[model samples]
Target: MRGFGDAAVEEVPDPVAGPGEAVVDVACVQPSVTECMLLAGEPIAMHTVLAARLAEGPVRFGGHEFAGVVRALGPGAPDGIRVGDRVTAVETAPCGRCAACRASHPHACPSPAVLGFTGPGAFAEQVLVPARTLVRVPDGVTAAQAAAIQPLAGALHGHAAAAVHPGDSVLIIGAGVMGVLHTQVARHGNAGLVMVSGRSEAKRELAGRAGADLVMDAVGDVEAAVLAATGGVGADVVFEAAGAGTFELAARCVRRGGTIVMVSVLPDHAGAPLARLRERGITVVHPRSGGGVFEHALRLVARGDVDVDCLISHRLAGVEALPEALAITRDKQRYGALGPAQVDLFDWDRAA
Candidate 1:
């Protein structure tokens, strides 16, 4: 991004492997909706904090969800990491030399370089990532599918914090990729009743296919519908995957003593139903994105337990389409995009 709300493709130097890092020949990349919002200089927390630095320079941002073959490995890279390995990596890499790392509390690391947003990302033909974050893509998963697995890994991290158990009820707000993934994950956990709320009929239909027992139009009284579905009780767990605006609905739909897992990164000023949450003694949680969840997510995808292909609505070729793809993700409703628009940097079929 050149400045707030201005983005265009310009030729940038191709990334090269640095010590302890590797250069991935990006096969495919999918830009998250949040990335598009941030790139547009929305008043999201991330942009707000980085506004000054961004204003000082042209930044290469977005494309944390991607997969590719290892093109080059720098010296000191771990054993078993080699060129030609197909991999998808975790976006957030913790700084292991910090006080938090010394204390064995790596999650509290004060400074972590968020790939794409903080540094160069996978929006181009190659991206440099910490070798430690790489997760091998299984044989059967396509590059496009591997590119899309990062978000599923994030969903799995949230599900772990939700502490979902068999016979528990789940309500997911926003039938987007995370919502649908949560729906499928909840079902896999044998949740008694799984519900999803979406503003679009198409998304609702997709939610049903993802194993949501009930799909409610988000414009209507979602809390009432959730209550009705639970026989006067609210959902045992509510997933706020729809971003900041849906926090209130998540609060209202969750039963007293139930948990609310916030998967989306909301803005600093985003409204929350704190009073109601306090009154109900609701446990609100924001899950961190680690714990080997990517491995579990990969297994699920490889085993066909989660259906990612159906959520992909647009697939564009080459990095040149990134600008238009970002716009499509921004105007998702207009474009009928269920998830981030996938951009293929290299021909996966040809590689296969």
Candidate 2:
């Protein structure tokens, strides 16, 4: 497993399933936030969080979240899952026997190696995954839709954490892919009104298409817009999906006692609004997917509660193309790709 932002792609040979694991003959690869980071040589934040538990050496496994068909299964694996079945995987594979996994927090597992980031990932022709990490794609869901399920989970988690209910107004702080998806997820959760604010005009339009009730310029006074749209009470929930410098506006736009949910990974070195958030007596939830969040997110996609296929705006097919794809997605909005830049990869023959 090797290749990080702009690095050479090496054919390290194919992989095989281990005991209780499964191998999916690669049919597609889902380009995610980590894919760009890995290709750019930027460190995945999870690495530091799990550094103490790592086995050392820079891991190159990438593509933790994607969908493909099960080609083979390890002996004694969970029986319901079988060969030729289509499925998506949870974020990263953690040793399911560790204290963290036992506690239903595989995300906090001691030894965490993310796929396509620090270890063998889905970008390649085949991927080896633990049996338990798999989530089946429903009959009606296309692979492209299934491919985006993991990210939707986090967005859903944000809405769930905010307790978004019918008729309640909501505000999303950015209009990038996560921001747009959060808008749809919030609407699906029955939020009465959903508004999105971003600096990019293109993103605002994307957000509107994704079900945003109103749009505001990120460079403008978004808090005032939210208040005006709500007749002065402000929104019920504020979503900080961009992890930008201005997320603190959530404190000003959310109604007193309303919730604020951070859905993106903010650059730690950047300033955080902890003090302002506390001063406003706001409760913030930064959801980490584990336990059943991914499954819940996937089920919604499968059931058509929230449609993410529209979020895809780009597709790439090989290691060589990944660097360019990563570059474009890193500044997804700058390139005028408001939603998450979907980079779908298929074998040359199959794609034809």
Candidate 3:
């Protein structure tokens, strides 16, 4: 993005791979809700860094959730990845020298290089990425599906954090992209009852299609409905994906000693029922990133276990449509979008 809330298609030199890096020809790229929020100058965690970059000049801002073919590899690139391979990458690359990495906890690394944020992203025709982050796209998974797998990986991570057990009741707030994905994941992961709450009728229906046993309007008494469904106990695990101002609802809907996974990119100091949560001994989990689940998520998509294609609502052609795609993703309800907006930059299937 050139500046906060500004994006355009402009000519720029093609990226060349540096040592330990690879250049991928982008086939499909999707704009995420988080990216749209960040671009619109939302004071999320990365706002300051983006502001600094804007002061310097126009930045190549987005396209982390993308799938493409490896075009070139530089010296010291990983051995297994080859040019022309269909691939998607984990956005976070931890510094191997950090204490977290030395302890085999790369996900906790304090210093990590984030694709599309720390460097130029895949919004253009080509993007440079660390070779180590590359994950091969399987045969059955389309470029669009691969481009959208990052969020599914995130959903998997959130589900794992909840430590769901068979026959447990699960509740998801916000039937947006993450909410539907979480619903599917929960249903497939052995949850006995899956409940979803959202403001949009269409999104609530989408959640039901994705395996939500019960769908409630967020504008209603969601807490009461959840309690009624759970036999006055409340959900065993709740995923709060509706951003700020919903933590209290999640707290109210979750059973005592249950888990609440904060899937949304919340503001620095979002209000919560802190005392209630503490008194109830609730385990609140904030899944940091979808670092290690890309391969598993891709496998699920390839095996038709997860339906990523059904969630895609808008597919615009060419990089020129990026601004429009971002707009739709930013205001999905206004645009009647069911999921993130995707832009196809190349005909990867035809080429293959």
- Evaluated with lDDT, which candidate comes out highest? 3
Task: Give one digit per residue, the lDDT tens place, for model 2 in 83-198.
Answer: 98887787667776898889997668877655554456776667887787788877777666777788888787677777787888989898877888898887777788889987
Candidate 2 residues lying further than 4 Å off, grouped into runs, are 1-6, 38-44, 47-58, 103-108, 291-296, 338-352
TM-score, every prediction: 0.97, 0.86, 0.97
Give the alpha carbon lDDT tens digit for every residue of 151-216 in model 1.
888788788888988899999999888888888888888588999998888888989998899999
Model 2, backbone clash pairs (residues 3+ apart or across chains), number:
21
Model 3, 302: alpha-carbon shift in Å?
1.3
Give the C-alpha miss distance for residue 14 in model 2, angstroms. Answer: 1.1
lDDT of 3: 0.91
Q: How does model 2 fare in lDDT? A: 0.71
After TM-score superposition, the amount by which residue 182's alpha carbon in candidate 3 deviates from its true location, in angstroms, is 0.4
Q: Which stretches of candidate 1 lie over 4 Å from their true place?
A: none
Ranking according to TM-score, highest score first: 3, 1, 2
Q: In model 3, state the lDDT of residue 336.
A: 90
The digit string of per-residue lDDT tens for model 3 on 1-352 reads 7789888989999999989999999999998888899999999888998899999999888889999999999999887899999999999899889889999998888888888898888888999999999999989889999999999999999998889999999999999989999999998997999999999898898899998999999999999999999999999999999989998899999999999999999877778888999999999997766555899999999998888887899999998999999999999888898998999998898988
Model 1 residue 254 distance off true place after TM-score fit, in angstroms: 1.1
